[model samples]
Target chain A: MTEPLATGSTIGILGGGQLGRMLSVAAARLGFRTHIFEPGANPPAGDVAHAVTTAPYEDEAALRAFANACDVVTFEFENVPTAALDLIEAQVAIRPGREALRISQDRLTEKKFLESLGLQVAPFADVPDMDAMTAAVEQIGAPAILKTRRFGYDGKGQARLHKAEDAQTAFADMNGAPAILEGFVDFSHEVSVIAARSPAGDVACFDPGENVHRDGILHTTTVPARLNTSQRMDAVLMAGKILNSLDYVGVLGVELFVTSEGLVVNEIAPRVHNSGHWTQNGCTVDQFEQHIRAIVGWPLGDGSRHTDVVMENLIGADMDRVPEYANDKDVALHLYGKTETKPGRKMGHINRIVR
Target chain B: MTEPLATGSTIGILGGGQLGRMLSVAAARLGFRTHIFEPGANPPAGDVAHAVTTAPYEDEAALRAFANACDVVTFEFENVPTAALDLIEAQVAIRPGREALRISQDRLTEKKFLESLGLQVAPFADVPDMDAMTAAVEQIGAPAILKTRRFGYDGKGQARLHKAEDAQTAFADMNGAPAILEGFVDFSHEVSVIAARSPAGDVACFDPGENVHRDGILHTTTVPARLNTSQRMDAVLMAGKILNSLDYVGVLGVELFVTSEGLVVNEIAPRVHNSGHWTQNGCTVDQFEQHIRAIVGWPLGDGSRHTDVVMENLIGADMDRVPEYANDKDVALHLYGKTETKPGRKMGHINRIVR
Candidate 1:
């Protein structure tokens, strides 16, 4: 934005899921308006958004109107089609910039970008076809995971190559899509840093949170993660390096594999991440607001941890425990207003202060 | 409210000011939708609410439609017309109940109700007319304040009787309105306890916050008020007594005057009060969510304080310092999204965590 978005300025959010819902609330807190653009009917974010346009990204007319209405545009979905962004970017600035999105959209490009930054990353080789898969397995060995280069989330579009003999099967699972074989790196645990950088180059990172995965989906993230002083610094420094390198101007979630060697970059999300949800209860300015502040060119709030927090995602059936959790002291619930409780769907989350 | 309002159920709010705006955001956080029934065009709450009914309370059709659309209804503005409420209450549950609203709507009734509960309120007597004013001043003595029995707030509709001779002028200031005489009490400072009660009779109270007012408007509220343990206990007990007496099923704010003799009941606000704004940063579940939980039959989230906080109201010109406050660490800004900065109008507030 040429200037910090003034109070009542509209912020256009790309997707209308939980993140957009929260970003909308945070925008209201900061005196800004939010307009959600999503092709879905009755999007969760629409409940809180000032305006919502139910039109596909391909609709240039809708994109133009949305772009014109917004002071600045940002996204919850990283895989927004390049053509849609091209249309919107022509009218309004898209925060985190196209470079961050371009690099993070494809796993292969993201790995190469992180590797080029002299960052520690999992061993990987691009597998264009079955022929390349053979070479990738020959180099990366067994127990590697074959993942599609794009549109992969929550363990989707991925297959495990448990042994050298499983390469063909894993390759077949890709369905002729461009894939990458990631070599296994044994790690004690996983952690993520949620950080924000203003357009003015000021950066702020919330304390890293230790994460646990259940069925390949994020189950819980506890703040004040068990990391030595050096490990914590390494994690934060790595986040700053990536943010600065990408000229990022919004919240970015960097997942790290805490290995014996050092912190390895597992992946990065260009928008607010579920792992940062604990900040809602643990910090004065949570990750959602921090992202709004950054994208608007306002100084980032101090997201430094105040209290230890454990954020647990309520996926599908986990939502049934809401009443039980509501009775728990020091627990703050952040549920998305979704009508259905489909399995594997993100229902909501709770941030429990670990007193 | 027969049972906990299921996710996606709409909660109708009676006002669309800053408090209603915050309440809407809180409701959305809990997976609930909000419909704001506000007469004003483009109210602040409309920015975050799922629906906005722009119709006056006198419009029975609008009230009926709004009531039919909501599962439960509550208010941010306490002075909602009783006629309008009677129409809507027939269709939906209005939380905190009509009893709380009835007593609080009038200064005389509220004070007498407190006095009947054995609460130490300021010395007062009815002054329904100029003829009655003389007897009231005589019984209550000089140096008292003449206030309208109904529709008074923020030091409005009040005149000070500094001496016995000032009674006629003070009484005349009432403009033939039903008035009450309040004998001034010796006090050091003011404080308030934000408390909540559920239909099941569960009561929870946040710590008393010492309030400082300027020009008859709340300026700041500092948590961990300098109150003795006995004083704190008395405040909480007083709140519980008031809540139970009226069958109040939502958050209530009880303002008190700390005197050498004891804590005196200054006044009570049946809805969320500005003094409780600090709870947004100091407690796990803030007053807005607590109020929502209570009205919806959901268990009240624990509101016990976790951090020391000082909430300062940004009224009128105070909004100019927003950028400064934004750069300050540990300060959480809650701007109202008001388009204009009118003198004496509350723009927003800041919760500064006093670490």
Candidate 2:
């Protein structure tokens, strides 16, 4: 048998957001070196990685160099271009490979893929134009969301259709981009299950966390999410189905809307998620490290939550209150080193472990 | 009052070891950047810092530039030169300042300082020469340790005196350096208290961890150290006293020997210590982050452990077992990413949390 990826191996990470930043920190903790590849100046991951490549995604030469430097490659965000993946995969093994990214990057494609797995997703229909948008509204009805098939995150590239006239306006604003109309489910609450699957087929998952959102951005995620045993099991089963189907390795966050009928998969982020931040303080192994171990081909760690944890996002100006939060003796303030904190920017987060 | 240190402020760190590496990671989490000043290539902290100055301590021009680039400076090891500290202090604020370093770098001075604080230390006498060594052996008897006053760690620069006749040989072997002969304390155990004190006089300490050593290198540290309530309280009090007396503003590690009578001061590490590694997985806020907050004049975080933890060091050959450890659940492995693994060198560590 081939030798397993050993200590001192370098892990290449795509994207340099806070997720990549935290992932680099976790990888370092596991005796693995991390090299970050991002197309920006002073990215958060740049501050913690062994090396960083600051060339644009189109720079095949730099991408090839980064891939050659690492034993295995993983991404922090799912929107990595297909060309970038192709360039890196030519030289280095990319975990949670192209199939996983292909399915997750598009709203319509992801929903269809989930349905193919016999998973329950919100009622969705593809809309190519204003006429189709109107037709989709008629089929999915009012209170549905029209989201671009590609490049949407934290509620961006989305528009809610409260009235029929809003559909045409939404379509025009979307620049006639391919879109999907998702029928809004009257959910009792929202929750996310973050799970990791190793190349060795070892799957470990943290407990589902209850989520609350502000302006479509996640506000707080509390563990022991108000779910019964069956609900909890359903979340885990859904996450596993997705990972197994995609032959995925590394962490995938599955957001679900808990309707009165049952749990409905809202979206699948093929990487670490904000809701999993609670694991940083509550679980024996945080989601970042779990993702690292999974991509590195190591057996997954114990994903058990050791404490009752509540994680709050310090969006934009909310980071100013870190000092006040630091005094509570109950909260762990974590600020992402982002220089400019504009409105809706995710600046940091605070994790509180309740006794 | 002056403006609080804002996000993006640079924190300069001296001595780029694992402690510095972890400290840089923590500082980045706070929206603060780190610049590491060390005299070698691939120093541990250099892997994560925003900037690194690889120059000797005597490179005053480079030192000034590093200090100018940082808002404040701190260190990860106590043995950094006094002149180095002087150069940085002349240009910027150095937390846990020069006085703390002066007392901690030299065993004789540290012992005397502890004694002056009305804290109990092992009985000791300064050894200026072979005659003084003989006199110290006569007073303290056999089974004592003859240690050089400075630049000793992991049992280096120390020799044991098993008999009265060994004093002359031991002293000569130490090259007649300024030394101290310490009577070994008949201790029941060894424990360490890791505490952080901010400039505002706020002090917070994690629960003491009982330490076990092998070959004079730390092997394991367990939290909720098998100490009674009284002893735990004593450890906390002793650590706090040291922080307050030194006007220290950073994390301080106080190693104490639990003797038949009570806890006796062993040696203090002015920065994060190996024994505190368990806090990364066990506590809401770890010693590294706490140190970052303190030195930046930010409020201190909670130093409470949420679970019982055991931290094992990955010294030299032990690093080879990292793959096996990575596959194990409940283990949080941390490697320094050092290129070389020389015999007896500290490569990394792993913390296992047992609830």
Candidate 3:
């Protein structure tokens, strides 16, 4: 096993959004410093991180300097530029490794990966051109989602086709990029399993959190998800299988569709997930700390849920309710240090412990 | 009631130690920024705070800039220079107010304040010189302790007089500083009440925590202390009385000696206390967040403990055991990010939840 990082060692994080900001705070709590490398100026993580490199990913000198300053590197988002990772990986160790990132960065690859593991996934077909898109529509059927193979998030880079007649328009919406046509699964509900894997191959998963979405954005995630004993075990076992298959180290967020037949894998996020925010209030150690521990080669913390929690995202104007939450006795508010509250932007979240 | 601080307002902290570090993290979670003004270079809080002014308190220009940048000012340590406070108070509001600081900064004033409130305190006599020391011994009797009136902590600036013959040496040990002689209170154990008071006069107190000290320094603090329901209620009521009497607007740690007659007030710290660290794991809002909420004029959070936790300090060489603790599933480790760990210096702490 790789040696654990010593106290005071710096961890290089490749994104400066809310995820990175929370990760920096957790790293600080564990006596480690975070050096954030983000192209955006005055990023939120810069407010809490020990250092920040405000240069584009293509800036080789900047990447070299950041890598040299850190003992290990980790990314807050799976879509981090490959050129940047190649430079950083050559200089320092990157936790969760490149394989996990490669598989999750593309929709077609991720779906195939799950299928290879004997995990159920939505019926999908690769559509590289108009002809392929037509064939995919015939195979995958209607009521499908046409998503760009790479760089899609928060409902962006996606088009829905209600029937075979809409396939041509949906393919045009892809803007000539490679796409994947996935048939919609008639699932009862969606749930996410936040799992962590240490360098020593120890895997631990938090209880599944039932999720609700609005306008293609996550609205709320409630713990003690409507899952029976067998379903919970199934989720945990599948998450462990994925971690071991990829030889992954760090926290991974596995989104699943709870269908009548069983659990179907939707996607995986190879970093701290928003659905896991309830762990901050419901468990002894939150997912942020678990991610840090995994990257640093420390033992994974217990992921047992001790209380029932419902985490609601405060998107944009939802921040108007801050006063009410501030007066709440059971609510734990976490606001990202964003200067602007643009429409649809995530401003913060509230984890209210009901029990 | 004073106006609550706006979401993006910056809170200025006087000392950038571990308390300030934790406070900065809490402030960030609440969507507030923190500017840390620390005389010492490379303070731990600097890593997490939005801004750090590394100038001595005597630097008028630095002090002015810091005060102008903040919406309100609060301190982690009680012994802040009065002159610095005078300047800052002129620019921004300082919570817990001057009265609380003035009373707690001096041993004699704090003891007298408690006595005036009808709270029990050890019999104490003022000792300014040789003659007064002799008279104090006669009044307070032997088997007493002589302590400097100001700037004493962790058993420093204290001398024990076991008998009348030992009084002379003990008096000479005062080093010309004004002192107070207190007859020791024979107690069962020591407990501390962490209480908070908001600007609107709302008061809340966490359950008393039993404390264990080694070398006159706090070693561990365990929640759900060994106290009957009546004793617990008595402690909370007295804490509320003190907060109301002072018209306090922040967290206060009240140390008490549980004697057979009643609970004797040992001293009061008008800021977040070390013995309250267990709240980080056991409460929805920890002492640091409670202090920030009180200072910012917001409604206080719930101080109820949901789990039993034992907070053990990792001082100096104790950090060597960090690896072991890191491997423990139930242990929540907090490291101060101190570069050097000298003897008796608090490096970090571990909050291990038993249940």
Candidate 4:
């Protein structure tokens, strides 16, 4: 049996973005120290973490020192280089395991894995070359999205096909990388479930949050999504099924599409997702604490939402509204502490308790 | 007009205990970095703060460096040496000001100030010497407590005089320091109001929390204290009166005695108090965040409690029950990350949402 990490143990975080910043704060609340590993200088997490290593993932010496310092390791982002994980895994345990990361890292692999578990997912076909792309487009039809199998996020590395004749142009947009064509689902709304599984096999799921996207970026997430009681239950059960199937530990974000037929699995994030940011104020124990608890081999915390919350993401110029929000008694502002605010960059978010 | 501190500014905190640790976390949440100045090595606050300086308060060089590094300076404890503040204040702003510190540091001065504000206080007399002690005891009568004028906390540096004849022994316990003879009030229970005053002269007070002590240390603080409507209003009004009179620009904790006559002022802490820890989970804006906002010249947050909370301190050996608390969904455990546990030492606290 794995022993729970004692208080004062250092938790090594693989990325130092806003997720790592919030995770570091949560770890400190539970009496744990956090050490952030990020290749970029002046990471947001560096401002709050106990220690920060500004070294690339390929630096074996730095990775060794960080892994040796921590009792256990976890990543804030799923795209942590596999070589770095292989090196850190030899020294300390990595939560959600390498299998969870591998399956979720690629679009083709994630869809196939979800399908293998008898879960409903969008129809998809691999596009290995120009010939394959043409054949897949003929099968999936128009208005489908063609996305690179790896490292695609937030409308990047993806293209849309309006007709069968547009296949060649969309394939060229892939930049010669492997791609997948997914059929579009005529859904009423999008929702995501933030779930966790403990090392002891205990599962806890937060209420699904209805997501709204603007320019392919998450704009806001509102709790008590437009879901019936049966749909909510089904989403949670399906999330638990995914966690148990992967033998996963720590938090995972599962995006779903709500349709007349049923809930369809969109994708999964092995680490904490932006959609779960509402838990920070709406629940007693938030997603960050639940992630820390699971990775440290502790029992999962209560993920039940006690209040309805509307979380609005502050992207780029949205930070200008901070002073106004700060004066609003109902708004709980969380800034990422990023010095530079470029357009499309997620600067912060505010979780307002509606009820 | 004093400008509000911008995001990414450093907040310098003196005394690296649990209070400083929690304050650091709050500052981080608001996009501010914290630099902890502590006399001891390996302080609990150091685990979460961006930087730490382990130097004695008398170290002028270190104090100057810390002051230079921060945009503003504040302390978690009131007993910060005057010399250290003198050096730091010249370089940066110190919230709650020197007058508040001077008044609250001594029991005699604090009581006198409260009485001057037309607030009811326990009958007291200054005992400067052995001769004065005898005279004061005769005037104050029996069943009174003789406490040191300064540096007295948690029932320390005090002695009870049952009769006038017990004066000599009680005075001896003062260790030649200045003392105060305070007449005991016939009170039903003790409650405290955690209030904040912004630089703009706005004052906000949280609901008074009923306090229960064990062996001179705070055991638990429950919100919605046992008080009638009149008593609650009187407690809050008195707390506001003190803050406005002091021209305070930070959080202040006021302990009151609920009596038939009215609420009697016991003492005031110029910094956040243990009794106010319940605000972390019970309210959207906690005492720590309120203190930060006021000190930074920002408007105060909502001090209203959304849920009832009972905060229980984990003193010394009580740390053994952390595993049990971790498993309980209702308990929000906060450990101080102190390696050693001595008898009566506060190791951590749990804010339980009772409702």
Q: Is the docking of candidate 4 incorrect, acceptable, medium or high quality?
A: medium
List clashing residue pairs in candidate 4.
none
lDDT rank order: 3, 1, 4, 2
State the weakest 10-residue window (summed lDDT) of model 2 chain A.
A1-10
lDDT of 4 by residue, A1-355 (tens): 2999998899999999999999998988888889999999989998778899999999999999999999999999989999999999999999879999999999999999999999999989999899999889889998899999999887899899988888999999999999999999989999999999999999999999999999999999999799999999999999999999999999999999999999999999999999999999888899999999999988888888888999999999998898899999989988888888899999999999895
Instruction: Give the TM-score of candidate 2 (chain A).
Output: 0.98
Candidate 1 is scored at a TM of 0.99
Q: In model 1, state the lDDT of residue A331.
A: 80
Q: Local distance difference test, per candidate?
A: 0.93, 0.88, 0.94, 0.93
Taking all chains together, each candidate's TM-score versus the true structure is 0.99, 0.97, 0.99, 0.99
Give RMSD to native, each candidate: 1.1, 1.6, 1.1, 1.1
Our tally of clashes for model 4 stands at 0
Fnat per candidate: 0.91, 0.81, 0.73, 0.67
- Check candidate 1 and list the clashing pairs: none
For model 3, the stretches where C-alpha displacement exceeds 4 angstroms are: none
In model 2, pairs of residues that clash are A29-B333, A29-B334
Runs off by more than 4 Å, candidate 4: none
Q: Chain A: TM-score in each candidate? A: 0.99, 0.98, 0.99, 0.99
Q: How well is candidate 4 docked (DockQ)?
A: 0.76
